[model samples]
Target: MSYRSMTLLRFCSPIVIQARHGHRMRGKAPDIAKSLKERLAPVILDEEVAKRNDIGFPYQKPPRSAEFNKRFDHLKKQRSDSSLEKAARTTKLQINLDDVKVDWFKTAGPFHIRKIAEHYGVYDDLFGKYAYFVPRVFLDIKFPLNEDTVYPVYNGNKVHPLQAKSVPEVSFEHKFALSYSQKPEENTLWTLILTNPDGHLTKENSEYVHWMVSNIPNNDISKGDQIVPYLQPIPPKGTGYHRYIFVLYKQDKKLDLSSMKVTDLKDLEKRTFSTFDFYKNHEDSITPSGLAFFQSKWDESVRDVFHKELNMKQPIFEYDFPKAYLNYQKQFPLKQPFNLYLDRYADPKDVNKRYLEERLAKTHPFEGPEKKLQFPNAHELKKNIPSWKKTEIRKERLGRGRINDAV
Candidate 1:
């Protein structure tokens, strides 16, 4: 009844299965090819070329805060997504309160930049103004010591050495001279500003203008007009480390300061300065280009600079640490052992062990209690000696009985 029909069905089944398999393979071919290309792509370590998919590196990183577009702006198209846009695409931040990874913040730094000829500095190469990762140059803030120069570090290394960027200490007497990696363009001027955001209690907003120079032609700072003559950082003693940041800005044109308020150069109130307010007022023209900062703590020179140079009272900051705990609380690891580790998992509204203990003591009067042990007090022996001068009266009494070795 079915021999002839079964033979025809078997022939059609093989053809139908082959056609379905072919359709499925065709549908997945494009995705498979794409993944294959990505897997097989070569990494070029010698030179940096912008990639369309990655926006972390400078070539891909849509140019300065435009983070570094001062020159790299041309490298990335204006139509592409901005750095902030890319940052939002990150569901979770790669760096956190505990970690120190700035590369994951999607900013890439210049690498392998050589120092300006004859300049004996490694930091001059750290920010990479010559190699071009946005920061046009780094400052060579030379101190008395060779290693005190501020160096920038941003090569996407596994370990971000933030301390490398800071100068451990700087002197008050020497005004750190800055050298540039490259000169400004013709007719273009530069401005060098030194500010201390950690002025302790010195300023209204905690910012102190250490130095300011405007209209510097082609990076020769000596030729510029010194508006706020370099005030050697007079951070009040005990103020800790104050970061003196040197920010260089490129002037769109010559700046006219006639309208701006010029505080009397000698006035200590001139110390109360705001770099943001200054930048806000001149937002139209000046563009931040290079940055280098150093840290300085209170030294003896600060006292002399305050009293002798500024002709004012030397502010000494002595933090009076609150005196020792006279009445201490019985916290764990202090006076008691922690037995209830499960307390952490208990409900917040639930009664605590302390309250339960007090309740139990009230209900059953603690059964019975005794305070029977006491040592003879040194104070009782000497009619009230203070703790510091108190002698071990019991030990002295015990020693009197053992006179075998007495001289």
Candidate 2:
């Protein structure tokens, strides 16, 4: 019977089973009928739609600063220098330097920490520039000047850029606290160094080591080894304001810097030191934690320091800043290109062999009326300077040099 039924089924018509909702049979995939490309195509999602709308970042960034500024400029309605002071007062970011707590030196939030760091140029003055490592610990500086001190900072009560008149004796002693330890046993060993970065501007301008104390078991100075005996600030005359920076590095163990100690005040080689180099030499064990700075200038005490302590005649520096060219004609607009020349215009110094050998020579003819300045633009050079402006500007002071650079 089964053999007869199979022969009958082969001769009969094939019966098709209709799947529900026009779907194919369970064994077949709907995409099997489509082309290979359609089957392999990626599915577009919400994220993809967002990407097509240029909503997210690009895969490759070509321009950084330019593109970033352009993209964010529309959002920057309240610029720092906006004349409309109340334009976005609600969104304005301001910090009160006076509100800093002394305990914040030991425990402060990141925002407060950054404010403190920027206020004192923690990175700029010491680390050379913004760097990977900025000292979290800060040295609490106390300079008993004639009128002001660096202690108990309050009400923007930090040390002023220029301290009142004071001699070397006022700064001979430095008070440093490694830890605000309530007990002596809780205190940690620390290394403190003070250096003046004003001698020469090339090597660092390298820091002139003023004072260094190492291997202090606690805040006590007498317990520490005086690596470089404390020398009072004696900035040479003519040198502008000098910054005396104090950096406290956390010591893992007591350092043996007795061999590097400087007993001779006249020894310039040992005195001219590099804080960064010293840090690098022992960086693995020490991390800079504290930073503070104060400005010092030449005082009469500097004379005695040079004569007695250093046993050398003090070097006098003369900063004869040339008088700036006054805009005598206030009626005229002097903010023109020719102002670069006129702004810094100064009288040429009297000298037979003044500047250029070719110019002012015996054969060099006297100035002609055509020697007048022919500036590229303006109401013309008539309103401003004539020729020899370049020569004159060279002799001008730095204040005028900025004007030249601006133009």
Candidate 3:
């Protein structure tokens, strides 16, 4: 018996045998051509291509394990408990404002303060009035796990770039150290206002109040009542950087803040807050005491904080890539070699020369006569023409199927 027949007989013990004179039976099988074609056929990946072209895959952070969740809850509870206990203790501590002075403003007044305001276009027509009172309040950000450090407040050396995402949940602490020449009086009442002059959508002398405490007794902010509860800085993206100004005013007496136009926190959004106007209106009642400010930008944490804490929707940023790019170009103007070939052959005159002349005319219209354009010498032109003509000839020859002979 054949090997195949023997194997089939072993596997199928109940098979019926048909006897024939020197004849073997064969089973039907698949077509070899058809099988090969199916195996070698090209795969169409249109669906995969479409999926790749569509929106990006959603990134869902993996859920924390039970133990991790428990630990996080415990830490959160501990923080809340400790914060309450600290607040209770802080309320009892006596804060002295008698030694505090607004002299820090004088040191920063000439160039530093103005430069910062000018950088963000925060100054107005009445900038000079409040300029002298710009304070030297030291600001610090305390992170959940890190020690407090001095925040960048108009001082370039110590100025730190605050990332928006990392700071929303973090609270900042500020204290005013008296300048040497000035002394605070015990009977003097003060007002503290923290605002973002560049927070408005439109360029106006407006500000969004982050924190406002009026009738502060002797610069003790913790003891004072909050007119506008502390709203952490939420500098929206694409608005560039924002300046969070902490302005302290020495009130002649306790301000009857009930008469102010914006008495409620809800009315503080995009409020017209001009330092000059405020000083002018209350010139008799309030004097500029101290001023401190820091810059901030949008971060990922802003979305959550805005919606949850501030009860506001996150603003959709308008991408200003072109404007930013133009500004960068202006700052570092490109110094590239002039395209002599294009200038000489493509146009009747040097295009770059014309463009420069036109720009100069617009910049200095009343200046002397237009400067002359000096063209390249004949020797320089002769040196470059041969290479250009050779390239053109080679290209022409290649098009005509005579590339082998052209070179």
Candidate 4:
């Protein structure tokens, strides 16, 4: 549901308050004042509101098993147990998990492109709520191209390997078309939509050109040479993030992208330089410098068009979640504090311990007599765990006489 609709509905609901009991009264003396206070009572949705909205989520059904019914009855008894509630009320907020920090923003050139697009007059219309026409932020979304597949010939555990083969004959025509009588500044950021050979959509088939103001020369609203990649997405199997960068450079006089109030070309002269050249030229006549800027830099980075997308940063803050199994009694009211104990054994065995260790290293990474010593390697503990061969036999005292024992 849209946020606006939910907000409107909530506004019509009544506010609830708590009241206190009066002191010992004789003959039930009349009270004049009313109290308006919210207490530690569970906030339940009003039945009338629920009925009016036709909302019936998770309706309870009669228990089908006697064992489940007995457990449910036991829980009801626990709800009435005041001792449990008192203990819960004393709990405090405690998060035991190591905090992690990562760069959430990944796409590099989108930053510059967006700034320039804004200067050129159409970023607002084209990009809308998204951070520019292209969202550089990774949202854990995956594509089928990166999915691991096994071949029958090799081991079943390993994914089929792939390599790059230059196929000069395999070429595709890429074109950028823009039409705006409303002036360039009033138009939207250009969007490039890609389609497969059989007309199905592919990841590399999509791209956006946003104005990058920081790199622009004095916020000049100029339309530069259209960008067309000689090579594009090559189908492959892999398991990593990849990035494609596109940079634009305007070769002519500064162009005015602002909307024209008079609908005339008179203001065009004031925007551009007198000596700047303009005209359609052949591909050979034009020279480009930063064409090969998107080369991969890190182990996680790949030059291939088809690869996984990863956020450069990790989630900054986190809180230990409250127990879902515990139906809060009065003692453990809303916003009550609690501690988290690590029951690490319950975690999946395959979880990447190295990743968690790396995050912990950033926080409090060391343990030694010297405070400055670096944190001990997590994997080191596995090898250093006491071995039977390394243990030595020690002599015992007379009172605790060294008897012929298993040791």
Candidate 5:
């Protein structure tokens, strides 16, 4: 959300007070939840704004999918040979996955937002209304942006220009008084209608990029969405932090971002990012914004630090953070370090050594195959069946037979 839009939202939010209680609005679905669903939804049209902008390459044309790859490959071939279109084609920003510096997936949370206006001397602001936080689990990927560096798709500061535009619009309100038949009633969502300050919207399919629905409540102010109050501080060595990016928008009409599915949110996020980029940098004077990428390894020590900072219990498994994290324990263990839940990837050498040791332990000398066979009841039975007894019986039977035959 842009600064100007945020200011406007803060100002107009007061008008919401006059809205009739339970008065149904015409056109759109009455359920506020419907808006909430589309708000964080993905673009799903055959052609999006990004794809239209560049006929050659469709944004997020699934690389693995045959249809996407086919189009992408065909477009690449056309661009390579078309010298006339080279300027525009080459101007687009390109990124490699390897360039990212920090890689993490965490639950979202709302932290660091000021609970009260500084002017109020730490007292909650009277007009404030909105509770917001990032989810507890999310993928936090960061791309470094350097000052004074500008790329076609990314601005300086080593960050993508698209990211800057995709910032979420945030607001607050309180609806605790609203009666609910459900035991756990839903919190009121305070929404801010935002626009592309730079006049750039999604090119092909208007992509919905960033979204965050948090449980953060506002105990400070009354009026507006009061779902999020305050962010809880996890002690250092904490469980890690999640940042919710609220990209708010007010459209002239409802959007079909979701196409009616919860899983579609991912596509919506990507589209939102792309749309923000298009609008933010339409003029080329400034850069559009979006996340670049991050390359981080699974480190137990880092996980421990997160735990300590968040005031969480120490985890038992310490070999690696991502590894132990992915290993699901039989029980839903108490606040184990985040590392305990991450998938661990270690050098092959270490794995081989462990495997051999386990093998040897299973085949130790006392438990060897030969010793077990000799000590068992089979050995006693064999000893009891005397070979000499069997031979004597056979000879006695033969002698008796010969005497009978002679008679």
Candidate 6:
């Protein structure tokens, strides 16, 4: 065969032709097959396919039939009802103590007097007086005087001797009274805390804890561990009489004494104690059971006793002696009743009403003119006056007009 004829034959052979166009033909065959398969396939609905496959489509949702709509509405109602029930469960109601007869309060006795007598009765009985003749003016309304409650006893005496010359030693036996209703259980515990609220004579606020004991079983304070040792009262020479307050708390359980910051005698002076904060922090654990107090002034006996027993130096009379005391006495006279002293001799409500009236009168005086002129409308004024002058005149007229119209 001729070379030209052989070359043409080789190029035109079926196998050679197939190799050159095989890839393109294969690619077109898939597309053609896919189109043909789609045309011949069954018309399966989305719902049918989802049901058959047990699958959910993200973009395609099933038709909402009556049953579905009813179910959805029921679900919404249930959720709303659940939310309302949750709100009802979480809501708290405020209780007014004055409006309610609290059995606990009655069993506790006159809250204030019971507390004071429990702590100070010993000193008062020993000193042959009721609460050191604490003037009614000095007594707070929260702690009204109640003569029925029992008091504490110190060194076999009912009264607290205050004569500086015969200031009692720090080593004195102490006892407390049990409430008639306080039938102690196996878990009952008590705590005794002694504090001087007026540690800083110049300032009206200060706290000096003289002693603290905790975990006394069944109101037996003597059985408790003394967290802070007892210290004799030593008022600064010039700093008016100091009220040494003793308070007792009924503990629901043994306290975590180690958590207390003021654990030693040295820590007492550095402590800034708050009875309210203490009770708040331990609300679930402790309740105030009793309280008592006695006033003490600087005397030579107190100085000598403090020096011998505490090895503490006498506080120097930095400020004038008796002057500050006299001023306080004058400010809170014994003759003045507690309510009058607290009110400063005027009704606070009346004062507040007068102040509000004066302010309102000044803010909206009644003497202004009853009739006020109205300015021309902006559209009407624009026909006669320049725009700038119109604005200025409008502002001026508005300012001059009575504001009572708005009121």
In order, the Cα lDDT scores of the candidates are 0.50, 0.56, 0.51, 0.28, 0.30, 0.49
Please give the RMSD to the true structure for each candidate, in Å: 24.4, 25.5, 30.7, 29.7, 33.0, 33.3
TM-score versus the correct structure, for each prediction:
0.41, 0.45, 0.42, 0.17, 0.17, 0.35
| Candidate 6 residue lDDT tens string, 156-230 | 122322332221122111222233234424446777776666555343444566667888775455677776665
lDDT tens readout by residue for model 4, 259-305: 31122222212221110121112112321111111111122122222
Residue 329, candidate 6: alpha-carbon lDDT: 32
Ranking, TM-score, top scorer first: 2, 3, 1, 6, 4, 5
Ranking by lDDT: 2, 3, 1, 6, 5, 4
Pitting candidate 1 against candidate 4, the one with the higher TM-score is 1
List ranges where model 5 is wrong by over 4 Å: 1-171, 174-243, 249-272, 278-348, 351-407
Better structure of 3 and 5 per TM-score: 3
C-alpha-based local distance difference test score of model 2? 0.56
- What is the RMSD, in Å, between candidate 4 and the native fold over all Cα? 29.7
**Local error of candidate 3 at 23, Å?**
99
Error of 6 at 375 (Å): 98
Name the weakest run of 10 consecutive residues (lDDT summed) in model 4: 164-173
Point out where model 6 deviates above 4 Å: 1-187, 201-204, 259-268, 305-312, 318-407
Off by over 4 Å in 3: 1-122, 125-184, 202-204, 259-272, 320-407
Top candidate when judged by TM-score against the true structure: 2
Which of 1 and 3 is the better model by lDDT? Answer: 3
Cα-lDDT of candidate 4: 0.28
User: The CA-based lDDT of model 6 is what?
Assistant: 0.49
Which residue ranges in model 2 land beyond 4 Å of their true spot? 1-100, 103-125, 130-138, 144-187, 201-204, 320-407
* Candidate 2 residue pairs that clash: 137-289, 137-290, 203-206, 373-386, 373-387
- Top lDDT hit: 2
Candidate 2 local lDDT, 1-407, one digit each (tens): 99999999989998899877765577446655766788799877675433322111112222567657965884576454565565456666565563454434434432364466567554555554434244454444454554554333221233432342222221111233333332223557778887876674336457788888887765666777878877776677878667676767767777888777898877655687876568668877776655555666777777877787678788887668757657564435555555444334434432212333323342336552124234423322343664556434443332343323321
Q: What tens digits encode model 3's per-residue C-alpha lDDT throughout 290-347?
A: 4456666776666766676557677867653432212222323355323432433333
